[model samples]
Target: MTIEEQIEKSRTSIFKAVFPNTTNHYDTLFGGTAMQLMDEVAFITATRFSRQKMVTVSSDKIDFTKPIPSGTIVELVGGVKHVGNTSLKVHVDVFIEEMYSSQRESAISGEFTFVAIDEDRNPTTIVSYQ
Candidate 1:
């Protein structure tokens, strides 16, 4: 399917983690925290397609385009990009909204691969819901 088709089946969410007053000296969100959220976003997208547990097998590429200030809002959007018999690939993008503004800009984006597994943790085919 085309990238646009994948995007149409995408899911997006906004998440925030409190950084106590002393957590940031520069008053910006920590890079590590941002990455954690990014991973979750990717996982969620893949899991939605699998309807089961998903583990990140690989990250194709992750590019950080900007920094997100501490008090700003973070948005993570993810969707399926491709699917094989037992594997699904998801693309996730992270964005940040300014404290006093609604504008959001891309902060980072990555692609993750997940393999479907059964209760025994063995690889299994991921059926298409479409």
Candidate 2:
């Protein structure tokens, strides 16, 4: 498949309900928890795109534009943004949706970098077959 096709095919999206256990005293999702979920989505996108073992190396500026309250739903969408010889970047966006309404808004966005790794844990080419 073409690079563009591969990128599109690897896009990942995950949905979760915001419960009290995952929220802070303010009843909003915690920043750390959001970051963890973003990283997980990024990891899945990177691995799907490269079809190789991938490790998160860094997370770029993450902007929390809005608070995600408990009793709401959240959708985390991840897509390949950039690809290099041995690494790639995935952009993740968190969208909040009300359980009772059709309202949805972007709450957070960030970019994560991942490096493809071999069985020996060494950096390898992202697109080995290509």
Candidate 3:
């Protein structure tokens, strides 16, 4: 498949309900929790795109634009942004949706970098999957 096709096919999205347990004392989703979820989505995007062993190398700037309160739903979408010889970048966006109303907005966004690895855990060129 072409690189564009691979990227489009590898787009990933995950949804979760923001419960009290995952929220901070202020009744909003914790920043750390958001980062963790973003990383998970970014990892999945990288793996799906390369279809190989991938590990997170670094996380770029993460911007929290809005607060996600408890009792809301969140959708995390991840897409491949850049691909290198042995590394790739994934951009993740977290959107908040109100449970009782038709309200939705972007709450966070970030970029994560991952490196393809071989069995020996050495960085390897990303092989295009059929």
Clashes (backbone N, CA, C under 3 Å), per candidate, total: 0, 0, 0
lDDT of each: 0.74, 0.95, 0.97
lDDT score for candidate 1 against the true structure: 0.74
Q: How many clashing pairs in candidate 1?
A: 0
Q: Candidate 2: which stretches are off by over 4 Å?
A: 128-130
The TM-score of predicted model 3 comes to 0.98
The per-prediction CA RMSD against the true structure, in angstroms, equals 3.1, 1.0, 0.8
Query: Highest lDDT among the candidates is held by which one?
Result: 3
True lDDT of residue 127, candidate 2: 75
lDDT of 3 at 24: 95
For residues 32-124, what per-residue lDDT tens digits would candidate 2 score against the true structure? 999999999999999999999999999999999999999999999999999999999999999999999999999999999999999999999
Ranked candidates (TM-score, high to low): 3, 2, 1
Ranking 1 against 2 by TM-score, winner: 2
Question: Residue 91 of candidate 1: its Cα lDDT?
Answer: 83
Q: Taking the tens digit of each residue's C-alpha lDDT, what string does model 3 give over 16-130?
A: 9999999999999999999999999999999999999999999999999999999999999999999999999999999999999999999999999999999999999998866
Worst-scoring 10-residue span by lDDT in model 3: 121-130
